[model samples]
Target chain A: MNNWKIFSNGLFKENPVFVLLLGMCPTLGVTTSAINGLGMGLATTFVLLLSNVTISLVSNLIPDKIRIPGYIVIIATVVTILEICMAAYLPALHEALGIFIPLIVVNCIVLGRAEAFAAKNTPLSSLLDGLGMGLGFTLGLALLGSTREILGSGKLFNATLYDENYGILVFVLAPGAFIALGYLIAIINKIKKSL
Target chain B: MEKRLESNFKNMVLVLCAITLFSSLSVASINALTAEKLNEVRLQNQLKAIRDVLPAFDNNPMEESDTLITPDGGTLVLFPASREGERVGTAVKSYSNNGYSGPIWLMIGFTPDGAVYNYTVLEHKETPGLGSKMSTWFARGNKGDITGQIPGSKGLRARKDGGEIDAITAATVSSRAFLDAVNRASGALSGNADAVSGATGLEASPGATPVEQPDATTGATPVEEPDASSGATRVDDPSRTDTSLPDTTHLSPARHE
Candidate 1:
């Protein structure tokens, strides 16, 4: 029962993107626009969820001497699959996401959950853990993206809010990206605490 | 006991192998499912770039390769405009080191008679706020007037330097780098000064520039062609030239304007 509780905690309480701050590289790099962040976050989630389950099923079998290396190989393999699928189908999103797609292999969120929760939990629980963590990261990115996009361009997903003539162009720039992300994270935490 | 231990190790290895195989299979399946759309996206990006630059082809733009140039020295991307096999126009991807952010990549277009059709910034790591606005800040900057005020292009200036082009307020380095990139790219496009001077095909309208004032100010004008014969040249080097371009080809005063 507690294992299930632990699995559900990843969705909010111990959220990887919001609380742990495990994967700042992708979190900052891809959240330029809401769509880009969402695409990248979802892609990472798929890789994480799949990798978590595979690692758990093989954890007992992997020799202690080779666990880290084996886990990496498994993670890398999953990322490659993701890379191929993006390149072959969603090339626009894939190209827009660029090298960050492959970098998902190193996202601490995926590996942290697998090691901390999935490896010890049953496969079903591990799957749930992956889904929850992925959703949390995705929401984080979307919020980061939304905040930047709305302020910088005055548009949400390309829909205009204010007149283009008066748009706050800075929000779209790199510095704006950093500033928006910092506040977004702060605000999300505030909302969480209030609840 | 030793035999039982040996069998367990074998089973463990088998499980790892099976997982690897299953993961790979799933990836392959996803790749197969999405390959077609990926190709479409790549094709769309190229078509879109050419369309933005060449305002002449306002109608149907064929998303097909007309001519492929395997330049020995530099990258060559040739998008030729042809109707019923008759030549219409051409756009070339060229580069310059004079750019502030190292080398700048630009796509210059020429009408069949070698007139300056239009140009686009392909990619660069110039400062974010200031120089990136070259497409926007000075869209109305007189073409032939080098002295026309831009924010960062002024002497020793970031936006902090208070050049006409506003530095990205915070990202000064990137702003200055972008100003330098446009200067180099513009010089190459004009084929007027020494940077990479070449035959200014008639479309260049040498004496007549957009909002033409005077050919008075001498910017870092270079010959447009960077000699593709020598492998040392980065001019049209295909390998060095791969980067994502914006959807529209028209050089605007927006981000990379």
Candidate 2:
């Protein structure tokens, strides 16, 4: 594949959230607000990028039978590093993300990319793939969060667009996450089909 | 495709060990680097919370704080603020174990006379949209506004529990927990040892004595007249004898299911 194609693949055609439907746990859990969605997305992106590059570089040294465990260790280490950095520099966002930050270690997207793409690819290609996929996931979460925020609280990124009293309260709750995700998937699928 | 390693038992064990070893070392280094910064951020947040709840004061409340042990074995920290040499108010770092999910921590500020001045949530593990509303549910002008209301005076129970304060919609448990914390803070401030212990369903200590009401005619300023009507018992410390305690009798039986 061309370099641009490899990078853009995850952005649209193979988008992690909308198309491939990977890492649904975090995609549904933390996207309560735009800022939260964005923060989680970026955190995942950092983990994904580092794990991909490290796995790609080390893939040749590790025996195939033990690759999964090796990949997980690498991903978890990256997540821990990210967590510490976030707690130190972005304490407010760190508090808001809470348990979700540690949960990123279990996010399937990071492992999926390492197994499917990075293990066989060059380090540079793996880097691009991780970046593209991470951005794609971020985009999906931010869109879903914005939709729910607007419908549920009459707010976008916490900026009030109308009276919150008039908002549909259900959209701010857990069930609302499912409903919003369903609609967003449908919309994205329709757009993809048209294209 | 890049060259691949053969899947052998020895290579599998060796590679896994190497990866885990490297991962642990990197994680340890990162943790060490960020530990100080994390502590600094936490201290800054606590200082800000104290500043937000209490009235203006020149004295460092943190330096002059007192830690009182509740009868239930919990500790409440009282940060008494002073303007010059006179006490202005106190910010009490209190907690309740009755939240819907887990414990909830709050910093509640009280005027010299015992009325709540302001409050800020220090920590909680409540539900996001529902119980988490405790952060703003009882702020000044909000629906559950408890500002200026003395906690022990009328008892800080949710309307669901037949109290005056309105509970957050769909979050009665959280509101009750919040009230419990506020009452505990008030109890700590007024030296009412039993008031703090009673909320947790614990009996007053054997050494506890019934608190005497401060004589209203003792030249105590009206703004500083501690509420004597709050059914508090056992002033623990002589230094805090003049402070007001909140009535927490109603909170004793109210438990989180």
Q: Residue A23's C-alpha lDDT in candidate 1?
A: 87
lDDT of 1 at B99: 39
Q: Give the winner by TM-score.
A: 2
Query: How many steric clashes does model 2 contain?
Result: 2
**TM-score, cand. 1 vs. native:** 0.64
Residue runs of model 2 more than 4 Å from their true location after superposition = B71-73, B192-257
**Could you tell me every candidate's TM-score relative to the true structure?**
0.64, 0.86
lDDT of 2 by residue, A68-90 (tens): 88888899999999999999999
The number of the candidate with the highest DockQ is 2
DockQ of 2: 0.75
lDDT of 1 by residue, A28-78 (tens): 877767898899889988998899998777677665555665687789889
lDDT of 2 at A55: 91
Native-contact recovery for every candidate? 0.31, 0.91
